[model samples]
Target: MPIAATPLRVLQVTDLHLKTQPGSRVWGVDVDAGLSAVLARIRERHPVVDFILVTGDLVGDEPDAYERVRQALEPLGAPVHCLPGNHDFPAALGQRLRDGLVRWQRHVIVGNWQFVLLDSSFPGTPSGHLAPSELGLLDTALAMHPELHAMVCLHHNPIPTDTPWLDTMTVGNGEALFAVLDRYPQVRAVVWGHIHAEFSARRGDIHLLATPATCVQFKPGTAEPQVDELPPGYRWFELHPDGRLETGVERVEPARMPASARRAPT
Candidate 1:
């Protein structure tokens, strides 16, 4: 495959879990602060981020958290496309980002790649299921962009993490999801957020990647839902025009919090 004039650069920041309030803590870490630190590292290291893929859990259940998320991401100066996680309120999130710099869009094309974002969030449930509409979108998008390398993004993992408890939440209809992709040779990657850690694997010609959360990190390949002691992190991707790509996970230390600011909620 010949290289295009420019490689598409993307930063995947997921499971932000930002609280409506700045100093709120989750699992003993100040998540809002953690997310800020991750963004700082991205800005300093990757000065020219073409796009940011926010895979969901942007907040807990706060209706106002979307606005806060939008505010925090404004400094990145890149278009952000978001998908909903089980913890997110899509309608509320859409309202805040509907007409802003952080809007959630379905299909985006950069260089020789076509990005298709899908909503896999199932209301009132931790497990995910891709609705038929999403399935149709995936089918149509791949059909429409046969000449472009396609990367499909969703909030839930389509393949099991193999970490017993976490696997329970993998996309319930993952087989169905795969069936759609199996027909499209143009699909090169499947990316998601939810497991809260980095995962990289391949299925045939497709890359399966899960990015680390911008907040607390989750211990991988465990029997249960476990929080790792690692600091906050994010993933970066460099897509070449020749259907080849490079990606890596980067973690940043949390900013120093005052003693009083370090307490977890009761």
Candidate 2:
């Protein structure tokens, strides 16, 4: 692959967990407030973004809240691509988030990169499972775009976070996912949300990354769900045309979290 003059700059915001109500709380964190803070930080730090990738959980279980999500994201003035999380209603997302900057796009091609967003949200459960259709999508995308660097995006962590409680809900057939990617050398990274903490590892040459949620930070390596005092955050990626990439995470400043959300349950 030939390197382009400029790398594609992208922002990844995930697990928003927004609600229809103005001030909604999830696990003691005010989701709406957190999202607002995160977006503000993004606008301040990254003024020019090629596009935004929202991994999942755009809204809390409320189907009508997709409208709220669209309203919130449209002001950013950049194309927004999203996929559903376990807490989202897929049908509602497609129906309500069809216009403007927000869209439920499964595959996107930009510069020398191809982003394949998979839906791992299974009906009636928190766990994730990639149906054969999703795997086929991945396979087809990789086969069709052999020259472009590929990044696989989804809502659930395909690999374990080492947090036992969270691992139970990981992609049920992660081996199958890797099986497809292993065949393609152009695959650069596998990124996801839902663990609510930052995770980075390497499988062969592909980067395996799990980003922190925009609403809350979950304590990793815990036996059960626990909230951390770390502020809300998002991931940034600079994908080069030569198949090399640079990425990192940035959190909100001054730790504006409420006291109630700063501690783990006793």
Candidate 3:
């Protein structure tokens, strides 16, 4: 995991529903703890990562939650860029991440790859959308980097993940998103995080990925809302100088439990 020798490396974590404790009635219990564990693992394994993408769901719309999340991530020291998730307050989160965040407004070139983040979080809803204005920004970014390989990041999955219940709150303008991608064959991949399950697919030449949540993973294609009991995880990507993108998900072991609910070691 010596990323220093690599062209460019990025780590992404999403849907971290971090809360104060395990059983707190408050929205995001233990997501910060889970993220902390992931951060520790990442630092130990890949110390040379250039940047990280925490794609959204930073604080679950609570001012205190966002505050805690901010404090937790301040030590990582990477140039972290984030977008607003459905659970986040854009204005509030934007202010906190102003220095750390990058807008989806422009095409960011890292090595030979162009990274574009999409703010697909619609206000007051659990689903996502890319407004006309936002779409225009994305279109322009892709057009500007016609020859550069691109990756678009968003909070919600643009395509269905085969789970009927989880599919209810997907990106509203998926067809439009795809249409725009079709216009730009130079785009490399589309990465998303809302599904909370590890899945991947191909749309023509474009690779679509849905990464695991940092705390809990929702069972894939299940009718019941059950947890996978897997450890918090994140994804890493190595962008070669030749525009070839190599990425995979890494599930950290020994699920980090809150102090109040530690499981007994057998």
Better lDDT candidate (2, 3):
2
Question: Considering every candidate listed, which one attains the maximal lDDT?
Answer: 2
Q: TM-score of the candidate numbered 3?
A: 0.87
Tens-place lDDT digits, model 1, residues 64-145: 8888889999889988888788888889877777876788788888878999999998888888999999999989989987
Q: Model 1: residues >4 Å from true position, as ranges?
A: 1-4, 255-266
lDDT of 3 by residue, 1-266 (tens): 12223568888888766554433322222565567778888889888777788777776546456656666666777667777778777877766556643321234566667788888888777888888877888899888777677889888888888977678888988899888889998887899887777989998878899888777666678664545666778999887766677899998865643323232110
The worst-scoring run of ten residues by lDDT in candidate 3 lies at 257-266
Candidate 2 per-residue lDDT, tens place, 173-239, comes to 9999999999999999999998888999999999999888888778889896677789889999999
Tell me how candidate 1 scores on lDDT.
0.84
In model 2, state the lDDT of residue 7: 94
Lowest summed lDDT window (length 10), candidate 2: 257-266
Each prediction's TM-score versus the true structure: 0.93, 0.95, 0.87
Per-residue error (Å), model 3, residue 59: 0.9
Each model's lDDT comes to 0.84, 0.88, 0.72
